[model samples]
Target: MPVEQAESLLASQFSIQHTYYRQHYPHGRFDIIMQGTKNIGRLYHDWSGDVVQLIDIALLSAYRGAGIGTRLMRAIVTEAARKHMRMQLYVEFDNPVRALYRTLGFAPAGENGIYELMHRDAMPFDEEAWASVRGLNNPFQ
Candidate 1:
């Protein structure tokens, strides 16, 4: 598809999905992912149930592999564990970040077409892991 057509198709698809989501979860959050003063990405999530759905998370090319995404995901993992709720998201089947999700303890629940659905059950927070990521001796501080 041409760039213009692809953009138009994506916009249309997003509009349809956003409308459906708003109908089902009127209070869902659509957040802008920021780095300092720069607008880096967007995160759309629904936080209303026992299983929180991470609708989307995307960062620009310049921000990829910089540990910012890892931190964000770890925080999500911590929060979900704290709440005793599962976390779920879908990623393109060929996405390299699938490894990161696996490292974060997400397992493949299923797949459809080009997307893989992944789930992480609630578990005790890994304080040591979080600490290690932050270069701290303890995470409880």
Candidate 2:
């Protein structure tokens, strides 16, 4: 694929293959959060249509223990609920953030051992879909 096409495909498109996230790990997915123009905090979701992922809820170390993580997660959940979409994510067994996800209604799907897969039930969207999508205007440009 041409460089421009590939870049356009990644940045503005959503038809991603499922294997891309697991195989690509943080890069193929997390890169969005680090680099997306609208700074949606880069949501990493599966292209498989069965699962949606939220990875690298990353904030600076000094920012830990603050309410920032909670706010970020609540925003993500609100978006999912507004879209009537379910979300899934994994947290390492020893990772400190595991406790945070639990408060947001995410529980273990028990697929990856130490990494727990949690989800929020699908919901109806009143305006969630239109909220952040326009930020990527001219997706192919």
**Whose TM-score is greatest here?**
1
Q: What is the TM-score of each candidate against the true structure?
A: 0.75, 0.55
User: Residue by residue across 1-141, what tens digits does model 2's lDDT show?
Assistant: 999999888765444644555576544343333223344333454423534456545544554565645555665666666556688887888987778777766777775866767766675433443344332321112
Residue pairs clashing, model 2: 33-42, 82-125, 84-123
TM-score of 2: 0.55
Candidate 1 lDDT, 1-141, residue by residue in tens: 899999999999979977886786677777767776677766677778888888878778898888877777787677778779898999999899999999989999999889999999988767554543353111122
User: lDDT of all predictions, in order shown?
Assistant: 0.78, 0.56
Candidate 2 ranges with C-alpha deviation above 4 Å: 1-50, 123-141
Deviation from native of the Cα of residue 42 in model 2, angstroms = 6.9
